[model samples]
Target: MIDIDLHMHSTCSDGLLEPEDLVNAAGRAGLGVIALCDHDSIAGVARAMAAGRARGVEVLTGVELSVAWQNWRDVHLLGYGIDLASPELLRCLATFAERRANRNREIVAAVNRRLDHEGRQPLDPDDVTALAGGVMGRPHIARALMARAYVASMEEAFDRYLVPCDVPKTYWPMEEAIAAIRRAGGAAVLAHPTSISTDFTVLERLVGGLAAIGLDGVEVYNSMASEAEAAFLQGLTRRHRLVTTAGSDFHGIDPGDTMGKGRGGIRFSGALLPPLYARIAERQEPL
Candidate 1:
């Protein structure tokens, strides 16, 4: 049975379920371990951990930071075993939230302007915030677009008005984020490398560069990763001497389905946990 999922989201960010409800669902899904790696937010982690304890699910301290490298779009870094009280993390997250809110407002204004030009009523930005509840995101905007029938699908919505440029550019440099994660007593793992691109040759160079700096692990098992992709990632892990990790990247939007099940029923073994724990411990050890 698939019991371990190290990545997911909750309403604390752009997810559809609240922290408690997400934990409950994970429990019902037979997930033994999970992490609430909400986008650039840790507000849900404490609640998730508490609920995890109640449901006998181990919730790790995880946060997925939005980062950008030179010409690379949306390079997310996942920090595991971070100290929840780290002031550095808290401060950065506050700025991220503000920037994200501003970005969402910009996109809404742009969309509304276009709608007004077409003689349609403008969409209230507040409606999008109501959907997100916390950190605003493109998914929230997409939902709002869908509700208004402005677009038939999420893809068309992005293609029409909510393009990436509409979003604010409040992001950390990849190196800076990795260092911050380390300072917070966490192991930094590159989240979903396969999502970067399909070109294995380019990915190899990217992984090498990241590893040369301080990347400790790669997400080898994820819904987006194919079997061949997973094997390629495993080879990268060995070559880079990095830890291996897996995650379903559950966002709680897909209701009625249990958590921890990655794309195409990909299952993770309990055996994968120790290496990550070991990496965390190693990071915590005094040099």
Candidate 2:
């Protein structure tokens, strides 16, 4: 019974826990294998790997890259078994981090303007980043708003103010994300497809385009998906002959209190399944 959590974040991204803390928490939770799929950065992977080694847990070097398509659909591509030390990948990630910081600033300013119109004190980026404990994002802004009793929850914050359509920032395009993952010799898995948009036809088109662009997998069993949705995604994976993957998408310190630990206990079982450890090991093997 190998417990695997393929999608998790650390403070290297927006997650509450540091890399080492995340690994230790996974070990405490009885996870046999874990992937530190931090958003747009592998900066935490090495630290997680070290922690995993100490805890007897296998850590997979992974990342979750944000991809935007022409249809205004935001796609998240999860890369597994990537070379964390790749200079090219690191450089690209640095650019992405800079862009993300800029986007966060824009969102902060927008949220502040909205709050100020309501005669409320606005949150500064510094305060939001302090609350985030690292690079800030909409989630941090939402949390700050919640703390001030402005928004009831993260979902409300997004729905009212920070939705992509209303925000001034855009995600990196899909083709660019796919190419970066491919160049790193990593397998790209679509992360939590249902949460992005509700249109199944649009999702189908996105999956088709991603497959054509060399996408290796889809996260058919995500913590957020209902049982029926999970089954549907599994069917879609089969239909497309795509590698089906599962993940908890654990972001420590839940803001919405919607997504739970271990991705609602949806763990991958069986030796035949493509486990994160196996992928990392295969990548480590000499060619």
Candidate 3:
């Protein structure tokens, strides 16, 4: 009854812990296998893998790609077992990173305008960037706001400034993202499909359409999915012939969110890994 968590984050993205500390935490949490699925960056993977080796935790190379599908502008695709050196994958991630940086600048500008209206000092984009270990994210900006005493907490930063001042995120087209994962020799699994839509009918159609376009698996057991929703997703994967996986989506910022187990005891059995591994291997096979 080994436990595995297929999704988590580190300072490489917006997560609170650094890559090495994240792995150490996972090792302490008793997660046998874990994936450091940083948002749009794999810069921390090597460090995390090294820490994993030392901690006796099996770290899988993973990334959470932000992608757009249809009218849904913020869907995430998790790529597992990816080739860190894949040119196509690297190119796309680099492009997204630049876009994210630009967006952060825009967000700062907007935040500055609000601050000006309120007669407060403006946030410096450089300061926000300095807070991020890897790719700049909203969480970094929120920390900047906190440091400036503009917001009391991360939530207030988002609700008052970060969310309101957000520039639209540029996203890879869903098809292109899935193709990039395949090119990188990885399995592209939709992370927390329930976030796209909790309505079963719409969610089913979305999953079906993605499956038709090369989605390798669906994350059925996710922290975001309710028990009933997870059950439905399990059946949905069977209906679409897609492999199923689970993740805690841990970022280590929120309270009560465990590593191997999510909030409310959402746990994944190691049994989920075999099919996912098989799918990743199938993608890696010469075509």
Candidate 4:
């Protein structure tokens, strides 16, 4: 059984739960260890660590950065064992948050324009931010649209409107993100390559580029992967000689779907995974 669920979010980013609440939930769920891999933000790690310590659960420090490929496809890069206090990492994350905020605004504008054209009620930017818990994103927009009955579901919202191809938006440069992770003494792992719509050749090129820029691992088991997809990723990791990582990608409050919790039904022995726990201990050793 997987006792450690490594990819979770908190109110520090897009998740619905607060840091303490997330840690407590992990403990309640019988998770021995959990990592707070918030999106582009380490703000929740300290609180999560404190909560974990109090509950006799280990908390790993992590962040999921949004990186843009050459073709404008977005990839999530998970950085583990980062020195959250490192000035370079802090600076880079600040810039990323700023860019994400700008992108959120643009997405909101697009949504509003589309709604106006359709003669429907538009979403207020403030309501969208509230839905996002301060760090606005396309997911928040999707939720707002859903709340207003503009879309049937979150997947529909993305497929029909919010995804990058459906709207004009900018993404953070990939090379710079890799450099920032390296500067922070962290390991950058490619997160869920299946989400990128590309051929095998493009995927290989993307992985190669990331590896050249100091990428350390590839997520072989993700919440979204099928058994076959997971096997393919395992093969890809071996081919690239990249460290393997796996996670549930828990987003807390599942939006009409129960897919991202409790290992995401991707069963594996926690004892067999060395890199995941080793990275956790390495980061917690200093604190």
Candidate 5:
């Protein structure tokens, strides 16, 4: 059986751990397989895969595409088994990276101005780039704040400053993201649907639209989903004939904690892979 996690991040994105460190940590946590679903980037996949191989863990190529749905913002689309070299896929991701950098600059400037009002040294966007270059996310900014001791903790940084600019002004249209995943020969799963909206009526419509747009799966077991929410999403998964996916959404929150474990140290089992693999394989078949 595979002890697996379908989502995670590394220094290549918002996460603090380097790609190799994340994979190595997964191995230590007894994970047989894991996915590097970094936000809008596959830059870490190759290094993680190499580390996974060395550690006897199978690394699945994954990317978390950010999109918007309805009033909801920052909806994540997890693309599994993607072709990192897909030109179209790269083109779309490049746009996201550019926007993310701009957002980072804005967040840093805002936080610094606030710090100045508080009579303190301002932080530079370079501090975030020093952490991770390609994609500068809110978490990266939060870390920089923490580094300066501007905030006692990440939670404080977020609540006091970072939360104001969390969402990107622009995101890939949901349809375009799904289309990119398809073109990359991967399965697109809606990530943590309930995190943004818990109303079944809302999710029903959301899932329906996503299904119609070539989304292949629903993230039924996620760290943020309550038991009741998971059950609700599981019902949607069944209703839409979608594959169920799980992940820890790890961002180096606790170095001692395992990357694959969720809120209560719960990790996904390998039992999920057979069906998911089947679906990806079926999709790749000439239709």
Candidate 6:
């Protein structure tokens, strides 16, 4: 069966690989279908699509939107099969891009203030920008920290500075993000349902509410979910009649986060792709 990875990132977001390089890596991993779900930005989609063609791999137009739910700061929503030319969607994403940049800078500034006490040289914004493919985020900053010898690894960078120095991030409301995805002819899936809340009761309510409002699917198979958690999520999707997807949530900074196959040998069967495609097609229907 052909393997499919429905969620991942490129340098367009926090990922280490360039768009084409990511596609090439996916090709090497034998992923028949993959989606570049960069954080709030689809800038890499076009380039990845071109690379996909060259590699004979199917690249879906996707974006990982950060959404604000009730009392939740930044819940992730995965949008698949989005229309790249959707003006409203493009405008919405542009706002996210700007917000992310501002947040990155703010975090760097905070980190710099802390670095001042250590008597270490501060990181240049340009150095962080150099690491990003297009849209910059915290991972770029983490790389900047590593390059400056402020941290030994990405984990250390985040632990020592990135997390503590993080600034408030602005995001579209959950409803707005879901509506935008639908309007753009895409399937909006909840990424790693566990991230929203570990409590099954709370998660059920969230998923049920989102399904009522137009959530098309959930990430039932991912590096974040254990077999039991995946099974629970699968049941949740079944109850809500939502399509299910698998992804590595790969950024390529960690050695364990593989492209097609995620950590612990997670694999997605080709069966997951049909329902996802059908959901996207359903969204394309005129109201």
lDDT (Cα atoms) of all candidates against the true structure: 0.85, 0.76, 0.90, 0.74, 0.84, 0.89
Against the true structure, whose TM-score is highest?
A: 3
Misplaced by over 4 Å in model 1 are 146-161, 254-258
Q: Write the per-residue lDDT of candidate 1 for residues 45-162, one digit (tens) a residue.
A: 9999999899999999999998987788688899999999999988888888888778778888888888888898888888888888778887788888889898887678788878
Among the numbered candidates, top lDDT falls to: 3
TM-score of 6: 0.96
Clashing pairs in 5: 2-270
Model 5 global lDDT (CA atoms, 0 to 1): 0.84
Q: Encode model 3's per-residue lDDT on 228-286: one tens digit a residue.
A: 89889999899999999989899988775677874369678899999989988988898
Error of 4 at 110 (Å): 2.9
RMSD of each: 2.4, 3.4, 1.2, 3.8, 2.0, 1.3
For residues 141-238, write the lDDT of model 5, one tens digit per residue. 88888888888887888999888645446778888889889888899999888877889899999998889878899978777787878888889989
Q: Given candidate 6, what's the lDDT at residue 240?
A: 95
Count of backbone collisions within predicted model 6:
0
Better of 2 and 6 by lDDT: 6
CA lDDT, candidate 4, residue 37 = 89
Model 2 is weakest, by summed lDDT over 10 consecutive residues, at: 255-264
Q: Which stretches of candidate 5 lie over 4 Å from their true place?
A: 165-168, 254-258, 263-265
The C-alpha TM-scores of every prediction are 0.90, 0.81, 0.97, 0.79, 0.93, 0.96
For each of the candidates, give the backbone clash count.
Answer: 0, 1, 0, 0, 1, 0
